[model samples]
Structures are given as C-alpha cells and as structure tokens.
Target: MLGAQQPASDQDRRQYQRVKVMLHGRLMLSDRTEHRCQVVDMSPGSAFFATDATAKTGERVIAYIDHIGRLEGTVARVRDDGFALELNTTPRKKAKLAAQLTWLANKHELDLPEDRRHERILPRNPSGILSLEDGRQYRCRIIDLSVSGAAVEINVRPALGTQVTLGNMRGQVVRHFEDGIAIEFAVIQRRETLQQYLS
Candidate 1:
C-alpha cells in the first residue's frame, strides 16, 4: 500500500517536510547486495522506502533513484514493510534535492503529467552516431529529442546503464524499447543549442 496523503506535523514542517511520491530505484546495501525498491516519501534530510530486502537500523544504504540519481544514507528506522533512511550529503547536494522535491510536489499538486520532463520534438535531421564506451560507433536514427534526453533507433541495444555518446552529447542508456533505447543526457542541454546537433 502507498503512503497516505496527510498534512505534515509542525515539527516535520519545521525541519524538512516529507512529500509523498512513488519513485522506483535500486537500493545497494553495505554488503553490495541490490534490491528493487520504491521510494514512498522523501524529504531533503531523509526518505522512506518500501522494499522486500531486509535491512537493520544503522545499515548503510545507497539508492539510485530515477531522475534523482544517487542518494546515500544510513537506515534510521525499520518498519514492518520497509525502512527509513537518514540522508548524508553535502549542503549543495541537499539544496539540489530540496529544489527537486519542490518541483515534484508542485507538479503533483497541479496534476501535471509526469512522463515528459521536457518537451520532446522530432529532430530535423533525424540522424546521429551512437558511440559505445569501448570506442564502437553505430549509425542511428534520432526518433525524438528534448533538453533532458533523446530516443534513438539503433540496430544494437547496449546493456542498460552503459555510458554512450550520441554525437557530441554524453549520456547513459536509461531505457530500452522494442525499436530503440532512450538516452538521458548527463547534463541537461540548452534548448537554443540542441537543434544545431539535430540539424
């Protein structure tokens, strides 16, 4: 079951308010064991995650959340169904997390669709080279692109998480579709300059 949408307590609000969310990701334990988990709620300081993997309080955990990237923490508490983590990060990273949480909260409040983070458009040229980390390159067709990522049609499907270069852009293999794979850019691209590579 998902977390309830309840108002935050005064203390929670005063500290860092927790926002209800559903994000899928992998959790790595101190022993290097990995388990699939869903983040039920998150704040800048900590997050509540639901997973089948057993973990003790004070266990080190590293979660690689989609969109949010990696977050390291120690298990603060254990629940019947899941556990909570006390996040450990630098101030700059904490600020970034706060901003991301705010955006997610506002998007949910506005009932906005979550699938598209950036506006995707079909490139004018529709062609680019996909290069693997091992120095292999393949001719691929650009299906669509946005500032955040791109969908390309290629003959080969590299393993998920493989680092690759598409033209001049560096990104990782994020998803695989029947016809192609999706690449999420390491750094968000500038909308004004993105078309230059596409064209």
Candidate 2:
C-alpha cells in the first residue's frame, strides 16, 4: 500500500472498493470492425478479456460491455489468444458498474458463489505515470479508472483545470484532495502512447 490510501469519500469508497463482474461482450476496435469477446474478469480499474485475435501491447481499443456499458482503452499485454486491458478511461463507469456489482456481491454473500474479483498490483504492474506539460513527472497511483476519466494520486497538487498527462493520456486536473489529485481523462490516444515512450 505504498501509494494507496482510503477513497476520498463514502461514494468513492463504495465505488472503488467493490469487486465487479466481467460479462461476455464484443469489442469493436474500429467503428466498422467488431470482434467476439468474453470478458473473463473485471475490476473498478481494469479488465481482462479473451478474443480470437490478440491486439498488440499499447494499441488502443474500444469495447462495449453488456450491462456495465462501453469503454476505450489500451492493451496492457497480449497473449497467444487474448490480452489484458489497462483502462485509460473508466471513472464514471466505475460508479455505474459499482451499483451493478454491489447487487451481485450481495447476491453472492448468501450463496456459495464463485469469486470473480481481479486485482492489479502496481509499479511491478504499473498502469501509468503523471506528467505536467512543463516537464515535471510524478509517480501516479490510479484510484479508479474508466474510458472517460481516472482518479489518480499525485504528490505535488495542481490547480483545478490544470492540464496534465498520464503516461501518454491527457486530461485536466479537475479537483484536489488531501492525499492526491483527480485527473479527468480527456484525449485518449487512439494508438498506444507507450511506443513513443520506448522509441
């Protein structure tokens, strides 16, 4: 829990702490392209999916969840037949998905149901880092993530509306908090920004 802390509020607590389901769905990378997929697992922060074709690491993909809704993200890693998605956008979805997950978690409470939880350990599995346009970089720990935005923790706080980049994803500093910063995801790069970083 080096960079981890309590959720900013009760609402954040309920939303971030819940375990979510990964229902089967389709992923349409291009508007005209679609592929069959099974959402093997999900969390407030990320998802693991299985598809016939493996997407290259850092490639951006657009996904549609059955009841949880849709998202846009980049491939964290690729396997022979599937891949792991480290969400570049997914905060609002977390709240919506959390409500759905709460119901499911409660349902499983009584029954001897199977656990469907997924956890992401960072640094070793680091999702992304935060950088100011001015050239300062802060190690960012994601609070909750979605295809639209993410709540991140930053040591040096910026003012509201201050634009910054996480990995290669860009957003504005929407709000400040006691232990971190909240970044609203803005322009999600269609291609994996990691390539630019490596090259």
Candidate 3:
C-alpha cells in the first residue's frame, strides 16, 4: 500500500515532490477527537492521509506520525479515500522534513530494510510490566519486539536515556512516539527466548 502519488499542483498551483509512505499516526481534529490514520504520501509542506474520520476543508489538524513526529496543518482538500493537509511549520522543521523524505526515498530505491540487524515481531501476548529505576512499575502494551529493541505503549514516559526494565529485560529509552517510547536493550536478546519475557 505504500506508493507515491502522481505529482499534482497544490492549492497555490505549486507542484511539490512527494514520497510514498505507509506511516501510521493519530489525527487530532479541532474538537480534540483523535482517529487512527495512515500517511499515504508526504512532502515537506503537505501530506495525503487516509483515515475514516471526516473533516471539512480548512479544518485544523494535528497528526503525530511514527518517525516524523508531530505535524500541524489545515485540511486543504478531500479525496474519496482521504484528505490532503497543507502543513504549517517553520523553515527549520521544513528542512528536517525534507531530509526525512529524502532518506525514505533513498531507502525505498535501494530496497533497504528498516531494521536489518534484528527481526521484529508482534508478540502473541502483548502485555508486560515496565519498571523504572525508582522501582515504580506500570502496565504496558508491547507494540512490537525485536532482538535489539522493543516498542511499548505506556502512560509514563521517562526522560531519554533513562534505564528501565520491561518484564525481565533491561533497556534505555531511545525514542518516543505518540503512543509510547522505544527502548533499545542493554544487551542483545536471543530471538528464540525474547517473547517469553515480553509476555
């Protein structure tokens, strides 16, 4: 489902290059309602998103994409399957977006894998308990598991680089997403036994 859209002129009749991506995220409307969506195509200044929620043209939207982080924009147009957003960002943010898009483009062109070092899997039993260094524990939902890292959905977000324990595995917070943080394990996990501790 990840494929580029044909180059089209924007509302201002300016054509911007776009790359195909299948990034999942939550879309927050002006009324604060959130819905799950997938970003189908993205450019530095705009993106095409597919979602079940409907919004009128010009409606404000705040999306927290997986790798790209938060993006604020206004609905520019609606398609049968989705809508387009005209992004509102500073010059610096735009530059970052450009770089991300380029990286995605090249990765796709070269057929590179996202995580080549480890094979990631969705745990059959996704529930786990996360404990902070202070001994506080919170229930967490495992998003995905890899030999080197795991993505978990938890309410408490510790500072970056904070050491934490998920079940019996120890790791440090390396990245944050809308739903949770990504932890890179202190030691590589044996793929055969990783799922036992995660559950």
Give the poorly placed runs of model 1, Cα more than 4 Å off: 1-13, 115-117, 122-199
Q: What's the lDDT for all of these models?
A: 0.80, 0.60, 0.79
Candidate with the greatest TM-score versus the true structure: 1
Query: Given candidate 3, what's the lDDT at residue 186?
Result: 59
Model 3: lowest-lDDT 10 consecutive positions:
4-13
Best by lDDT: 1
TM-scores, each model vs. reference: 0.56, 0.42, 0.55
* Model 2 / residue 28 / CA error / Å: 1.8
Candidate 2: pairs in clash: 89-146, 89-147, 90-145, 90-146, 90-147, 91-146
Clashing pairs in 3: none
Give the per-residue lDDT digits (tens) of candidate 1, residues 35-108: 97878799988899899989999898999986689988888889988999888766677678889999878855
RMSD per model, one decimal? 8.6, 17.9, 12.5
Q: Candidate 2's residue-wise lDDT over 1-199, tens digit each?
A: 4443222333543456535343555797644478867666665555678889657777777787644567667777788778877665445555666676676456446431122231211222334588987898888777654444556766788876566788767766655778887665553334334344323
- List runs of model 3 lying over 4 Å from the truth: 1-15, 115-199
